[model samples]
Target chain A: MRAVALGDQTTYDAGTLTVSSAEAAALVADPALAEVRVSWASPGDSTRIVKVLDAVEPRTKGPGGGGIFPGFVGPAMPQGRGTTHVLRGTAVVTAGFLPRAQEAVVDMSGPAAPLSPLGTTHNLVVEFAPAPGAAWEAVYEALRNGSLALAARLAEAALGATPDAVEELPGLPDAGDRSLPRVAAITNLQTQGTFKEIFVYGRSFGSIALPTLIDPGDLDDGAVVSGQLGHPSLKNPTWVFQNHPVVAALRARHGVDLLCAGVVLSPEPVDATNKELVSAHAARLCKAAGFDAVIVTKEGGGNADADMALKMDALEELGIPTVALYAEMAGADGTGPSIVVPPTKATAMVSTGNYDERLSLPAMERALGGDRVDVAAATALDAFELPAAVVYASLSPLGWGHLTCQEAS
Target chain B: MTTRVVHYINQFFAGLGGEDTATVPPASKAGAAGPGRKLAQLLGDDFEIVATVWCGDDHAAGPEVMDDLLALVRAAGPDVVVTGPAFTSGRYGLACARVAAAAAAEGIAAVACMHPDNPGIDEAGTAPVVASGEVARQMGPSLETLAAAVRKVAAGEPLGADDGRVGKIPRRNVTVDRTSAERAVALVLARLGGDREATEVPLPRFDQVTPAQPVTDVTTALVALVTEGALVPDANPDSLESARATRWLRYSLDGRDVLPAGEFRSVHGGFSTVWANEDPHRIVPLDAARQLEAEGAIGKLHGEYLVTAGNGTSVGNARRFGVEWAADLRRQGVQAALLTAT
Candidate 1:
């Protein structure tokens, strides 16, 4: 029996380098090379090494044509230029030696090159095949047979085990039926800075009727995706994230529990004075909206200055939980964490966007499983990385993990 | 002495229009007509019909129409005003209440005679002499009651304690506490003749019932089969329809198993089968039912879902629909039924 070694198989070939049973046995004895990728290499064929999986050569034309090839082409393969090839034969690696006297039987033949090559000397065109350990079928079988611990790890990672699992509160109690406090006033926040435009994100905005989940790490990507998705109901794609009606409804019906009333301060190199004015106006708007907690997601693509610090101080003085999202560092070192002030109460904040609502339900489900979701934390986990979870948390009864048990009760 | 009286009727009673006229408006004239003369004769020299006003019921009930009617009553300078002893006719009763309210606002004494079953009695309160009996023949007694009420006003006497003859009018001067439970107790006590100074209202304690334990996990949760399957001894028991309470039925399914979709067939006599046929999909349980079934959630269809043609359905009929549908759904182990109201 012959032993074969596996690593990245894109560089290997099957036509050259014929292996005897003794060499295969010797290779198989090493623990590190347990997962073998068999390839054919033609002896002394240095110029052309056919990689079994390289059915199609990379196209050099058009945008995004050159890069690492995408894996997995099921039934619906996209139309493109590429060579079609079939597998030649299975090269088995074993732990026993066969003397030169015995002939080897090979099954599975094809016109293509070996899937992956081990060395990079030749422009090896390797056809792709799953390594022994990396095959999905093998993994699935292992899982079914209880040979894999991945399932347990996944179950552990899920939010099902929390002591007081967060659950969605039943549909908001009927306003007419429940004893609700009459809303005296609804204030619309307008940004007064020279920047004039502040991009906001939240639920019920954008083109998609449903919100996309966002984890903190994916905030930038989430924003881009949300903007690109654009709400089907909106006329202007950019303005979709700035839905004031949703804010008004949230304030009127759900009260401060569901929204964060705040403003964004664009970083310097834009307009320093305008940022201060916008910050002041935001504070006033918060008071008007009857919100005492404000979250400020600092605008990207600018340097953080004293203005950012001033805005934060002003918000803090208003006696509200003030959080700054994506705050760049001040000074020469350029190092500082994004600012966050943990809310002491179940404070409701009104947001134009910043937080996505689609992920609220799932996040709430996870929260119910005992995850402490910090709404104020604009960390990667809380904003864009796991946006769906963020959205779920936002829509949960506890108001996007900002709610404590006492408030929920 | 001939005491001047103004009679106000709506467009319908004045023969000017129908339901369309009910929404038209209030118009006035110098002297009494039709029923106004009948009222004058009943008063018999003691009262004279000085003016008559006919308005659409909708107008008379509206703010602008009421304002116009009040101006007319003031201009007529009638010693008193008399509106319909509106029978069980709801529109007529509503019109009568509006006119009476306008007259009272102008400080002109007014009386509305209505049957005990007339909804106007409840609406107009005790200010109008809401006759306890039927409308047609009770005119004689209604007139006598109106004449006496007018005489009391002319004699400078505060209107006497309500005799159940007239319905009660809401008095702005009466200061009652606004808390519902406290108000309920006070109202009950006042009816019992408890003196306001000595009244001690006892508040009722409301104990919150604990909610049932939620299903532990969606995947492993046991779906209890609540269908009237082989679990019961009798196939069809004689159950009293009115005595049933709404219940929640739970069902569980292993991963990815589709449950049977529950069928909803309207069986109540209140609904019109005509509309149901025109748009069968409107009544069909498709969207909501299919979604629930696909999610492995409980599939429940309340027996005998009530359907009614909203068009031209009287308030009485609508109320009856609500009551009957609620009762039917309650009996079928339904916690809540998806009601599609047109």
Candidate 2:
């Protein structure tokens, strides 16, 4: 990769595309590509590049026009010739493309002037893309195929991702089954120093009536859809995975014992009232669904007191224990209020993503494998060997050509 | 002789108004004020409705409210003070618990009741009596429990085990078995209770802590000011974990002479929305490595600054990260670290 960039041309070697500085300079010399920037993606991957450009025309309003005008008329009738000077910069180029394996191509090549301070912001972006026949092929192929069945089977056999494996056991009958003790689940709800108890039921498990105060329609709408499982919502509109399901399922299925919930809060205040309302509604719904507690999953959005207060009020009112699930929001000793409290009745289960139902079965199975997982587990899983191989399989149509039956096996 | 009792009710129950009226302090009114009438009927002739006091829950929870409540209790001159059987209501339970505890402290027998789900059960449990079961409509059985409680108080009987009806502490009796000679000696000792000098009890002493000396040189000294302030990134990088357990990234100063204050911004993992201008001199290290280098604190900034969102990072993780980061910095010939704990 380094050699190609230094060689004054694009070259694909070991699944990496390298562009020479001379090529980049030449591309920038072109008028049409003047504002473009240079970026790269390894073979068989899509990479988005964004460059802010200076000196651009600004749109103006016509006299007596209350709204946007339809088309461009000859330079406005010069009454006073109002000249607008652009500061900052404009984002001119936003493009992405997937390259073929072992194929070296310049994903993005252009020129952009320097801005104040950083001395002409020139950055070479290189994104890693999977190569054909890599180990991650299985996982990538499964997703590309949208083969829920194949995914389910592979997940069940290879990773133990099964419905029975994910369902929490305490919600099941007391059959003195030894597996009962191992069943655990964690939600990503942020509960403040409160206790949370959750009861998971199977599809066959009779429906329990939610409190009348909570509407049933909301729950139905919030329920995890196919392909988007394991995602729970504090706010119905913007759904994410929960933390407790992972912990709960682990305890319920793999004999690894622990129960926890995840909480997600915007680090900043969100203006979406619907999100807030749904969050408030979901807290009540989850409680009515027999959750012992709720925790807020901390997503690094901005935080608003109104949003936090609303969620807190709902959980406190429901008599549910609330704690913040600590992942990567802020350190416990960091500046402000923590999502989770120590010695809190709330426990923490480290996982990837908010506790969404869509990821529940797979995540639970992952937890069951008894791997030492951390906050970076999701990123590591995304870089899993099988996923790389699957990506290679899907991109075979681009140039690498499909693997033969014998090769696939 | 019937035991005289005074009942306390909030302004809403007193029919004064809603939450707005709750701000008013306690005022004693003659016979059967609002809910007091219903309570009177439930108590029957065994209890006399002496006076009823009306106050807001906030007033009851406030210190000033206690003064007025104490005055009302004195004026009512009742043998017992009985407050609500507040069902799942939070403020109501808090008010009842406060008044009941105050009455007990004044040597007046007090009793309060609430439903099992009431939040006050935990807070009010330390008081003289707290009866909990169902709602007010189940007052017949509740009244019997209250009556039994009053009888025990009047007869000077030790309060027994509580079934969550009255009082926070459960009743328990301690029985001491002794031989005849020991019993005689015990009886004589009891008779001479005040005169006997018991064994001296030792009190535990805490070790004194010395104050830490102030840093002499700002340039050389590595000052770490740990704050529970919110230092989240503009884009909350970790959206999956607790707000407390965020990852800390090592910031580099990028060969700059002076650190730019504006570069240091906080994400929202705090109680307040606004960033704290804690100290004018305190600089947030957006590019920490460079700043340290400029200050001559370290030889060279090394490695990618370990980055973790701190929103919901746990104390355990924070400590671990701090130790790990410190260790890594040490390996890179870095000396003197300034850890800004948000």
Candidate 3:
């Protein structure tokens, strides 16, 4: 994987990208969308992007037209292979309201800036509006596909440019390393309803069989796409899946410290029966693979915690050590219990942070995506103090950033 | 301007007497008492210990006496409240913690100091606590910690994380350099190596409730339908919030045989609610309940149904709603309820 840092440029020159709004709209033309507006929000800009649907880092694979998101944009081929050029420090942000969507914001610079990675990235904000009589599902479908196509087009700018850095992600080593501990990862994907699901290779995880296994490399190549628009702080965005920190962490010490076994994707359903069923399936798969330990993390809110607890309990009961990661909605003061459901046997857990921590955001010089932000009262305000949960991917359940919940005396 | 402070202490701390005076009632004196004088010196001129309140450990332990003592403290109207340096004294520590907690609850800045393992630490609640030593020998240092904490709270500054100056309150979020992924890997490695590393989030204990007795005569019971599915009239006359709702609303089901499509809609953000919109009975099950009523298999259904959106609501709010809902249902002679959750 190679990354080319994007700087201020009207054209692709010296690691800089110049986006043409006209060309970008043409690239993702769809009948579901009546209009598509392209704008930019660079770092240090006094800007806030509201109603965020999803964010994707621009990247393309190889010197050819092959893209990173294989099934969505390029041919249906395995990812995490060959030379993939990433337009680092830049993101293609999809902004639009989905039916029954909650509020999500990203401040370019302020007290809320550190909450989301998009706050620091050079964002190409793509705002999509539905056409007359367009069904919500059709509009959402177009938004997801159009955004991916736009991301691929933007990443093309990095194809002929010089890369700032190159990273090598090696495949799994031979199973002959008996001394090393074999560790794997389980990512719980939110698949409750429309606009609240994750697609693996263009197919929703809910549609797949229980405890589906995917190559860790495919995740890096953008096989996992996020469609969840529930809670911003808890939901996993597309970018996090592409640059999975947990997968990277395991891969970092793959040959030396431990064996990077593989990654399993589990669907977090709403009801209790399905939650337990999926958890059991995931645990059985891990046990069958002879995993020494597994790291479990979830996507979305408290509902996922129930899924995490069941998964952890199933794995621990099967004699596999599990480390679970979660974010807390422990009220505004951080005094409430972090998890809605606690695992009986799983003791090792990592907290991403408290999503309900209050933050005071100052009025920005400019606002992008929308004029009004949907919050408690769904009003337009220049400055306000609200929960950190409103920020996009601030307290990411996947632990993409460094924010954490710690005890204060 | 100097910040005024109300100081709280036990009988021994006030030098009023020892064990025998432990049963004495609450008393107050103007300005600094025994330890308050030292605390005053440590606090410097920026703070004034305007009043000192003392109570017998035995008397303070009583609920009514504690309330009276809190009233006296409230009358002082100090900028901040500082309690104890209770050290290893269990009863004294408990009194100090309760006093601080009460003062803080009333919006007064409050801090308490005690040994970490003091039995009273559990009663500290959300009050900020400073760490102290196990014995009187650590009085000077403990007072110093308390004085520092008073200043910070008085100035509306939060206690710093990981600083020994304060005792544990609850978990707070902070931005660190390493992501939770790195931390998870480290924890995994530690577990694999047979090391017992503490989890960042302590396991929470949930309260258990015994099931209510089933209705003895279904034909004579008044069955109420309740849901957390946020099903409401199309206009939502009560304007119930779509999510994180703090209040529940009741709608009349007086003359309707069915909750027809387009007449009612679900505002719940947790689920798709498409089918529920097509037919609200999937959520409230009102149609089936009505069929049973018409067939004389059960008593007549209640005239109204209660609903609230459960998504993103805090446990505290949910508990309050449950308590209120139970009272309301019982007052209306609701024999049993069918509560559905989203």
Best by DockQ: 3
Top lDDT prediction, candidate number: 3
Ranking according to DockQ, highest score first: 3, 2, 1
**Residues B1-342 of candidate 1: C-alpha lDDT, one tens digit per residue:** 777888877666566766644555566777767566656666677767788877765444333456777777778888877787566554566557667756766566776666655544444423455463465456566656655665665454555446335433221111122321122222222322423232111111111234445644443332222221111111212221110111212222224222222222222112223344333334543345545645766443332323333321222223223333433333333454445532
The clash numbers for all candidates, in the given order, read 93, 147, 2
Q: How far does residue A118 in candidate 2 sit from its true spot (Å)?
A: 57
- lDDT: worst 10-residue window of model 3 chain B: B160-169
Model 2, span B152-246: residue lDDT tens: 66455556556344322321111123211122222222322432222111111111224335545545543332222333234434442323333
Please identify model 1 stretches exceeding 4 Å from their true place: A1-409, B12-24, B122-126, B135-140, B156-164, B169-342
Those runs of model 2 whose alpha carbons end farther than 4 Å from true positions after fitting are A1-409, B132-144, B156-163, B166-342
Grade the docking of candidate 1: incorrect
lDDT per residue (tens digit) for residues B199-306 in model 3: 888776454545788889999889999999999999878888776675888999999888988889998888888888998998888899999999887898999998
Candidate 1 Cα deviation (angstroms), residue A340:
50
Error of 3 at B27 (Å): 24
lDDT of 1 by residue, A1-409 (tens): 0112333221113222222323323322322233322233221222122101111111111233221111111111222232211111212111111111011111111111110111111211122222445543332222111201111111122222222232221222333432332221111111222111222222212111111222121111112101111011111111112122222233333342332222222222234565466445555655544543333322221222233344546555665443322211111111111112212221222111111112211111111111222222322122222221122111111111111110000
Docking class of 3: acceptable
